[model samples]
Target: MGGDLSQTEVLVIGAGLSGAIACQRLARAGIGVTCLEQGEWNPRESYPGDKPDFELQALGPWNANPNIRRGKADYPILDDTSDIKPLLFNGVGGSTVMFSAHWMRFLPSDFFTYTLDGVGTDWPIDYHELEPYYLQTEADIGVSGLAGDPAYPDRPEYPMPPLPIQPWGEKVAEAHDRLGWHWWPGSNAINSRLHQGRRPCVQRSTCRAGCNEGAKGQADQSIWPSAIAAGAKLVTGARVARILTNPQGRAEGALFVDEFGVTRKACADIVVLAAHAIGTARLLLKSVDAAWPDGLANSSGVVGKNLMMHPMNRMVGFFDEPMSSWQGHWGQSIYSMEFAETRAEHDFARGAKWNLSPTGGPLNAALYPLDDPQPFGVDLHDRVDKWLGRSALWGMVAEDLPDSHNFLTLDSAHSDVDGDGLPRLHYETSENSKRMLSFMAKRARESFGAAGAYEVAEQTLAAEIGWHPLGTCRMGNDPRNSVVDKWNRCHDIPNLLIVDGSSFVTSSCVNPAATISAIAARAVDRLIHCRSEY
Candidate 1:
């Protein structure tokens, strides 16, 4: 256990999105960095998108839900008491491997949620402070879209033109135009054209399962390889058990299980955690010691509190036109921000974002879920034929207010199914989220009707759509109420940093991949410049 693997200037845990960014930055700065990832690199060709049985595979083995996936890398989160199931892919890319690659920035209003909307607490840093990092991350990860949307403040152009908004999307766009609503071509991490040595998307549309063509900007393709080339050392299948701290209460490194089942201790001057909201919180709570009897850096007793999952609703519009609706990138074609910000007219304090995306293949069409379940046996062919190329979905992501009652806890199991202990997630859909979903779903039906959809069906409060896990470990100016500070440094442990969704102060309605990258880059910039202090 006390060998060559145990020494580093900096030790980064979870070699996913933020971990990749941290390594890349530190390596570029010539800092000695070593990263440990629970999952190994999944080769581009290994993705199931190009395979013949893509649809069947997507439902089971390649599913985004870790409980269903149960891959070698994935650890389960007990969700029997959860309103929405936790969905994450554990690999070099993290959840980006399964994400549809909607690259969105948080609106300026999002930073001052508590002040502007009288609800969730405000973020320590504002959008203007994070804007530069956002631009940097977009360029680094290869985002594609036409800019100059009026929904937010004016911005610069995108790297490439917008991805094709298919016929189904065009209809919705036209409807939004007619209704005088705000609809813009979606900005996505998936390539519209080629950029940074990756192929352009051919639009096979199995994005959630994984993009085999390397068109989507998964961290494995877009971030990690470059980090490795820049001299960062990444060790795969290194499952961290707990963080190691010194007598002075500084982060020394970590204790982990190597691929060969050997318990190893890594020594470092600084430690960073980029493990997602659930895993990062779980890891902290599990890393208990005399100094931190509750959890590492949990002096405020809020390490795993204030969970926000961005509860969602889906509305399907069935058009008479056969537009090959299933063929395009499942990534958003267009998104509406007409109701993104709060208004006094609405009883809810915050808002929801509506994204127009393609529904999947035959199996997804046949088993298409609405408020009422469809029976499997009756008129299967008719159902499939009607839904296959005629359906498009408007998914509403509603921002949830952070609640202390919604939290993550550890079961007292010596070993879980993976022999790595499992975490239990307790969540209840908030009244604010339910109200917002109801209001947005009704508006979605109106938009569909305006788009000339023959029939519109709704799936309100979908349990299967918990994609954005955030706000478990919030950042704030006061150490008494938060886990991290404005710079993402732990208030209790000076040398420990958390640069992932776990540090989010408020849940934004849009997808958080872009914001997460920006946060990591911004935090590391501080770390590199202030290295002498640590």
Candidate 2:
């Protein structure tokens, strides 16, 4: 409460994936926009993968888990109550800084889950409504992929051609064909040919630790530069402590700590929260006031409930010959949707999306912290050599149904210097998710066996792989049951907007970045069109 109280037409919290898109769209519309990001922009040269000793650094400082990295920008997360640990980065690009850049969209059946499968709640919006935005965001983010896959509906081609499938990819594809299962070249955010100013991928296979080749579609590399070039202003190293609301229960702005550790207030006509699911829900729950005793826009008591962290199961195939697996795009060579949609015979209702990815360098095979250690017992050197250039993984991203018990809340046990409670994740893998994982594991081994794998390893529900956290502050029509409406506006406060994965109603099995961008774009477009309504 010391610095000058600032005001902007639009205030955006978080400079991550969806937040960057909201800033871009609002700035493009000539609106005055200011974004406050908890983390500073990381220098491209600072990324570890460029150095000769990259594997050493990737294991230490560049790890995706905030609890492990503990960088200056990262905050502590209480995850002892959770089965699967949540993973995210706290920088301008958010978790995109460390993501494998797997760009995927929800299938048509995904939106109609409650209608068709009678499981989780249905979205107020549908796939068809978001399809145009998906195409637009794909072009904006410079995605690379082949168009006509039988797994999806008719869509336009990607901005660039698909990356090379390599010998390993070809083997997997041929096996899928022989087994009569649906598989297609993976949609990657990396560049095949130079489309934007960014360069093509060098295929270093150290993608999870940031790309030195400037190919992966992290928001910092692909979105923010242009957003800033437009009229948007981005302030780094600003951690929002609380969202402000007026007597009318309308969002005013946010109270945050600046880089210099000074408390400040930023007021805006409209405030947008795009800090992903966990961060967004935490902020809302922490924003309790007199008008809204529980939290801002907590009429439904859904601000921090129904958390869905898209849980994944990892299984790998060890081949006889060298696949040169360390040198290709680790962003998924190909993906199988044979179990993406539910079958009538399935005891479980929804399904999982499986991505085929290359196993990384020798250091990755050792498994210090990245994932569950492969079960090969002794002869460490021999196992590392055997697994390094010979294994490919079929990781299943399973759909997580929303349950109130598996949620996020401020941990009462832990408090920061300001005495504010830290965010804690309380999640349990459901029986349906377990059923999906078990079923997919069997099918995955069969598919790999078809590709002539001599041996296969299974790691059921690894702890360090909650890459897609979603559905905490879900969107729906009824105010009593949901946090936000179809337009991405909170039911309790229309002036307050949430344009992130936190607004998801259902956790689709595929990667959520593409859908997050689409939803952000659509939400901000509506905001621009109806700014006076607020």
Candidate with the greatest lDDT versus the true structure: 1
Off by over 4 Å in 1: 1-6, 413-421
* Displacement of the residue 147 alpha carbon in candidate 2, Å: 0.5
Give the Å shift of residue 31 in candidate 2.
0.2
In the range 44-119, model 1's lDDT, one tens digit per residue, is 7888888888988888999899999889988878888799998998988889889999999999999999898778
Clashing pairs in 1: none
On a 0 to 1 TM-score scale, where does candidate 1 land against the true structure?
0.98
Q: Model 1 RMSD to the real structure?
A: 1.4
Task: Report the C-alpha lDDT of model 2 over 353-404, residue by residue, as the tens digit.
Answer: 9998888888777762323454355755766876888988888989999999
Error of 1 at 467 (Å): 0.8
Instruction: List the RMSD of every prediction in angstroms.
Output: 1.4, 1.6
* Worst window of 10 by summed lDDT in candidate 1: 412-421
TM-score of 2: 0.97
What's the count of clashing pairs in each model shown? 0, 0
